[model samples]
Target: MDTIGHHYIVEAAGCDPNVIGDANKIREIFLEAAKRGNMEVKASYFFKFSPMGVSGVVIVAESHISVHTWPEKGYAALDVYTCGENADPEKAVDYILEQFKAQYAHVSEIKRGIEEEDRTFTHTILTWEERLDRRNGKP
Candidate 1:
């Protein structure tokens, strides 16, 4: 089956609190990630919560990359979706994990718009966990 796009869902734990709490920083990181993924930037928006955390999105020609952070919990959730062969969604995901300094991450990749023989559209998913850094007593 052929997929029209790739969607990466990420659960990043033990991230840097300062990085995730700053809306400006997160916006910068997301834009850079999109560029590295071979995506063309369309528009972007970010918001800072009352006391903590940040939420942002970078809309790209291929698709979009978005994130929400929980500074108190040292956690972040991200979605990287891209269409067409030219873009690599994984690159964006990797950049995010690196910039956040995540100690552990659980990632899921969904192949979107998969066409079946009967002309019905469906999706396939693959998931894995990555121990990005070992210093923080992560399991």
Candidate 2:
């Protein structure tokens, strides 16, 4: 298999507006989620917008989890990307929704790092003729 990563796009709605705007709460929720998902949380940072929103990212050994919340709309958008097969991104999403008490959430999953089989680029693989051409200084 060419894929090496798993990515999840989450659309959360009907969340607790006040909790979504709290940077500290958001960070706490993400940290717990990372732990639950088996991701190593190395560092985290968050910024609270003046009008009422929070944006934060949790950097993990596998990859990262980010959240952008719009409290006024009772919504949050999240992206969870992790390398290797052991990490469970869905667990993280579920925890986030639970933390915010989200009434509804739509999640879309995609496998990353997939290479097409139709063609092979020289950078990836080269035939004997191509190697010889390189040695001969021919394009």
Number of the predicted model whose TM-score against the real structure is largest: 1
Tens-place lDDT digits, model 1, residues 42-96: 9999999989989899999858899999999999999999999899888889888
**Which pairs clash in model 2?**
none
* Tens-digit per-residue lDDT, 36-123, candidate 2: 9999888999999987899999998858999999999988898888877778887887778777777766766766666568753222
lDDT score at residue 80, model 2, on the 0-100 scale = 88
TM-score (C-alpha, index-matched) for candidate 1? 0.92
Over the full model, what C-alpha lDDT does candidate 1 score relative to the true structure? 0.89
| Least well predicted 10-residue stretch by lDDT in candidate 1 | 130-139
List candidate 1 segments past 4 Å from native.
1-3, 134-139
Model 2 TM-score (2 dp): 0.79
Listed in order, each prediction's TM-score against the native is 0.92, 0.79
Best by lDDT: 1
Candidate 1 lDDT for residue 101? 88
